[model samples]
Target: MLFLDDSKAAHLFFNRLMESLPDHVYFKDREGRFLCVNRAHALYLGLRSPSEAVGRTDYDFFEPAQAKQKDADEREILRSGVGFIEKEERANSIKGVERWVMTTKLPLFGDDGEMIGTFGISRNISEMKQAREALNAHHRLLSTLIDILPCRIVVKDREGRIKLTNRTYRTALGLAEEDSVLGRKLSELSSDGRTQRYAEDDRAVLEQGASILNREDYDASPLGDKRWLLLSKVPLRDASGRVEGVVGMAADITAQKESEARAVEAQRALEEKNRQIESELQIARELQTELMASSMQSVQAELAAGSPFLPRLAFHYEPSAHLAGDFFQFVPVSQKSFALVMCDVMGHGVKAALVTTLVRGLVANIRVDDTSPAQTLHALNERLCALLDRPPLPRFVTAVHALFDTEAGVVRMASAGHPWPLLEREGEGAAPVSELECGPALGLIRGAVYRDIEFSVARGDRLLVFTDGWTEEADDDGEEFGIQRLAEALRRCRAENPYTTLDDLATALRGHAPGRTLADDVCAVLAAF
Candidate 1:
């Protein structure tokens, strides 16, 4: 090696070693100025040489706003003299290209143990993130949302003890709200024929991955009450496909069962009152609207006021002539989380609207805080399929369920034969993030499974969740306003104020249709988080 001064030799020795490493190495002074950089760091920052990056700050190599956070992180390390073991961060290069990096920073001290600067190493993990994204796209698992569902959902372990239960199940069993009556086996609920039957079905599910669909049974409660239950049970499997537990869902049909026995005698009276039923239907429609509007008023008001829990909210719903088969609502999962629910029952008119009514009632009751979107949709599917089978109507329902965590800035979404949502980020420079998967419509096939995908949503990001009516509405020329136009419209509005997002979409959608009246029901919600 060439001869040099002690300090210069020390610098040279460290530089040579660090430069040989593939990861970026950097040194920052207490004031956040770059003291030294390795070859990898220089290349990453687009510097001609390590010397060229000396004394420069991250602002010189990144956007000023982005640099502020990095500066804060380094300053905090210097002030606290504590090391950041490993922090994975998302960032953009000087060229404004986005990537992921795993960074480690430690306090640099002199021989006397006096803190001098910060020594950091950052490894580009963009390739790893890309591979993970691809894998998530193909093989996504929607875990259990069974806990927060409004229905009487129960999960039994291999030993037949209850592993989990939803609120509805506890209430139905006459348990107190604060009671955690877990490990209660099916046989413990009652010593009747129904419990014996359920035990056999649970065994079948665990042994053979069997699925029992819409099996009606009488629940003889220990409280000395009898109720009709439409129960469905399915096997739970591990990654290796080994059956581990069995999940059971129940729908109460006590009222319907009671009404059926009176239907025959009331048929003659109903025949005489057929002409007056139209007025009654109108009253029912008005009542439904009033109920929905009342239920959603508080949340809508809070979101409009720019509450911390709900940054922004906008919605538009248009029901086609003859009936209202479209329904959408917001359910609060907790103090800081909420769910946007959108559903459309197929084949318009009284029957379809009635189905929507049923769907809305179930949604209003479900607690989404402890559930996954996939689990929520599965519970809905099981209930709707069983309920609709009573008359076997010529219709199905499509829906999208999304849970938003305000504090953490995360979104979990699942769809039931619904269209994928459109996303618009904060700034114009940010491109729209869209596309995932849409599962089958509910009530179509027995025991159909749906999956969920999760993504990070920023504070100012806007999500457009709509029904097919919004995208499939045809113009006078018979051309539908497709996804491309919708995306372009969302992009165009990204530069505008967040408050203008819903109006922009509504106007754009209406203009595309070229008529005062829509041919189909349309339900849309624009949520800014």
Candidate 2:
């Protein structure tokens, strides 16, 4: 900066002043020939020293195209007598390496108020160029990744204009490129309802600097196709804590919504099926009840006056479920003879109750007038085997058939694999009558036969025929209320009517099996003579 104008020291000082500066410094004549150069400028041109670059024109060192451009700039500056400051230039150096330079050129004077040449200084900015290029490359990569994302992404300015859009967003609108949609208002692409909603959301994020997250939307196209979307918006902020704009993203949730709708439909179908099943069960229960009532009425009647038989007939019936396997009836053969038949099918439910009906039909077909107890049972058994063996799964029934001959004062009784009937005489104790196991249970063996035994009966003697469901009941302690307990119960009911004796038996079984539900159907036919 030492300037002693019009002195030899001034020329010498100026010559050596900028030699050590790292920037390229040189003075060139109007013809673009180098008049002087610093050591740094000589090194940049790949010269041994300033002496190598001095007096050389630009064409001698630079490419022809670059030399022509520079010659044009120098002539322009010389004609206008103006200077260029901080201009950026890009070119290959004398060493053949491309670089950028920040350059300043000014008109040089001869100290006589006349322009002599151009004074220039250039600073190599290659490192800055490399950094800026790297930043640009990263921005391009980020933009590519955003465009390829599966979710629809878009950016809107503070005025709700579409500033940017990704590939998915444009494709959703059936557009091939975002160029046609960018810088347009949202109302141009969607309905008023959608645009108003978008405007509200944009205001929240861009103006209020808020975030709208996980907002769901529903839409239907003209074809009646429905869709679901999840959207989120956040404010883009500058370093000064000011809102720059808003960034919005939306994800399609149509599949998830459809799956939920299908699940709801399946649940509704299941509920309807359950209702159908319940209705069928109720119908079955009502039909079974009607059948049982009809069975009772067919056998229920008071004997005529002046007859030898009892004046009162009583019975007890209870089913473990809606349908029962146990059934009984009274058949009046003649004025002086009658039969009480009680049967127990193997299991309880619609299947077993169906078997009981079959047993009833077979018993009604028997010729009880001329046949004995054994012969009547034999006829019922053969018919049941024929009917039951026809089904895929077989079933069986155990029964007791008792015929009272009032005129002869004797009882002819037989059994088919069933528990013995109880007889309580006026003077004797109650006991299960011993009879031979003459035949297998009905429906188990074809052509099975039964046997009868006759015993004298007094005028006031009581008879009880019942199914095994009464004797085999169990208490919480797992002990059975066996036939012995039933016999004892019958003995206690000797003073009451025949019907009261059956009730006492049921009450005794419940006492023994306290707090227990009925495990099987119970039935009894009681008569006094």
Candidate 3:
């Protein structure tokens, strides 16, 4: 028999050593009964002491099938008389939570050289298994992100062979699944010089260990169309600081480039139109200056000798545009009788200016025997209708014709779609004069009836004739300089001379309007008796 004393001491020492181990340790007999258990094993099994587990079979603490498997493993270890290792195995805790473990079983022998039991140790591998699962999940997520990205992505190895490409990259190149482009270089796919250049650029970035971004004006598409793209290339490096590959992303900018092109064309067209309008306005200004000079000369020559009965007429005329369509005329019918007429054509600029010139010529040649205001208007209407008979001709003029008989102090007036004239008596307030509106706008209808209306004019009385331009002008705020404002402005300046009164009225009208540019031409004639 073996010496029981030293054997018992050796067993106690081995058990004490196993009790200090970090992992769980136990010994099972060939019958699968727990012969001994260490502190770690008791703690793992939720036993108060090793004595509670001694002499108990694995089936006493574990399920029957699991206990049978353990019993078989222990018998195998004892029979083999060698150590065996299980890299990974499932274990159940006392609370029934499953865990992964790395386990080792060593056969134990008695002094007689016969296997008695198996010594087993187990290490928890649950954390390592979980880490591997997490890494696999992360890789799957990264692959999904690459496939779903809107931009084209590509990865190339140091040899310029394509290692990976995203969905957009394949779509952009019109690649087929059987093409096997993953290991092919860009030059193999596209032999064009432009593709070669892009590969060279990517290689340079990899060599320099630098990134390129937003390199514009680079051809990116394989198609012959002139398309643009924004390209970015980043060098991928290994742990040793060596360039391994390049990751590139390209975004198509064809639409943005087309928009820029269209904007340039629009800008050119707008500039050309502005130049044409400016040229037309300059020519119109020169013609208006010449017309004003000639009209003033004619007026001075006609009034060379002071007339006995003609009123002393001084006037002021201002145009908001290059050319004005407001016309004024004074014709002497007799030694003591004169007719004063004012007309405003429909609009401003060259067209309206030409219409005013026609009115001037008609009034200058009108016969003095025409004593009726209605008759003069009838003759003027026929002349305008004949002149404006062509296609796209302007066909409207608002007019007031007055026959002033100085000897009788009578003013016979007639209007055709014109603003009413203001009359200011010497000691009375200003009011609109009564006149007959007997006709439509001139050139609108031929043979329209016009009637003359008579009003008496005495000394220190005034008759003011004006165009709708004065009362219908718009400000920046879109409000009109209405008739009420015009009347108020005229009444305020009634005491001034004909020229001074009209000047003050025009100035006030301009000041009241917020915008610097006038919306229409303004014209006014002040006749003081």
Candidate 4:
């Protein structure tokens, strides 16, 4: 360093240095009166020259309160031989403009080593203070934003130490106080060691720089309540694209998993119940078949021993479902006279099968020899109406009852909303007995009547009485095998044996049906006189 040799030159250098400085610099006596001030300090006090502020105190320019506080601070510094270094305080210009200043004050000493006064410097820091406050406010807002999210969020460093966690994650950890888990590893927070598994995942993200998304895991709460969690972890990287840590999020899906489990259990239970119902239906179908077959055998034995004019009686019965709605009854009016009742109840399956059972019981009670064919149908209708009248939907049956008097050589027939039978004469081809007056179906009216039509039958003549399932058989074009078609089919199957004729007729009707399948229950009775 070079030294100034002349005193005047040293004095000039000092004054120039003070004038060029932007900060306020001043020297105050022990009584807190200004002895000399730099140009910036004089200008701040509203003085045109530094000489004007030589003997003035802070009270001359500043408010009394501010000046008093400054005097007290300087006195303390002087008495303790200490100094204030970059202490922040409020400063007001002579024009009453408020500013923030960073100040340093020291106790000054003379060349003789005795305490002389205090010299201090101050710099404005108002803009820097405002910027710092704004940054702090933004940080608080961001913290509050993440805290309100429902998803549990956590951030960990490469060392597996927790760096940040939101409110939801803290609650999962059983932490009531905020940010207490920071700087601690997850394994340290719990003794169950389940957190160690989570640490393994975090390590993968930090080491391999790969993300794990939507990983479902079973978790237990601190109180040991079982739950399922869906976790997602992403590697947090630095500016250089190197993995630095991990950011993990989790969602509690316990309710959804439990609901799915319950649904699966319910579905399994329903399937088992359906199987039980199917087994019961199969049993019912077998029982119905046995009952019908037993009745047919008994009637055939009676006819084989008692009557010779009525040579052959054959029937073809089929149902579209496991259970049938069509059934027939043969009541022996006498050794030489018998009546055939063929019925088709509305619908198929279990409900219609039940109705057929009711009809069979009703027919068993009627006296076929005493009542005419029309009178028998009237009785059946009244009984059905009385039994099945009150319902959301109406149940009904279409029936055709025919009395064959082999001794008298005549057949009496009546219809109740049923198709009239086809009469195949010995010489003439087959034709529907359309002369019968058809009445309403049974169970529809309380006192409906039907008129009987009588016609003579010679030996080798055949009578075919069938339900609508035969006449209503449809082809692919929706054309029904109507009464005329059924008459034609019967004529085409005119064999000497009634059983052979019925089998051939059934084959012809099935050929007309689509896919050789019947869409409804079928019942037909053929008698050769």
Q: lDDT per model, in order?
A: 0.76, 0.78, 0.75, 0.83
Tens digits of lDDT, candidate 1, 145-190 = 5445656887888999887777677777777542456787867765
Tell me the number of clashing residue pairs for each predicted model.
2, 1, 0, 0
What ordering of candidates by TM-score runs from best to worst? Answer: 4, 3, 2, 1
Candidate 2, clashing residue pairs?
A: 459-529
List residue ranges in candidate 1 displaced over 4 A: 1-288, 300-309, 390-394, 428-434, 494-500
Mind giving the per-residue lDDT tens digits that candidate 2 earns over 107-214? Answer: 877768788888799899989989989999998998999998988888887787888989888777766878898998767876545567678878878767879899
Per-residue CA lDDT of model 4 for 229-346, tens digit only, reads 8889999998999888999988888998999999999999998997998898889887876776666666666664645466478888888887888888887766677788889989
- Residue 517 in model 3: lDDT: 73
Pairs with backbone N, CA or C atoms under 3 Å apart (clashes), candidate 1: 145-372, 459-529
On lDDT, the leading prediction is: 4
Indicate the residue-level lDDT of 308 in model 4: 46
Q: What is the TM-score of each candidate against the true structure?
A: 0.44, 0.52, 0.55, 0.64
Error of 1 at 368 (Å): 2.3
What TM-score does candidate 1 reach? 0.44
TM value for model 3: 0.55
Which portions of model 3 miss their true places by more than 4 Å? 1-138, 155-164, 173-192, 195-211, 222-226, 234-246, 266-508, 511-515, 518-529
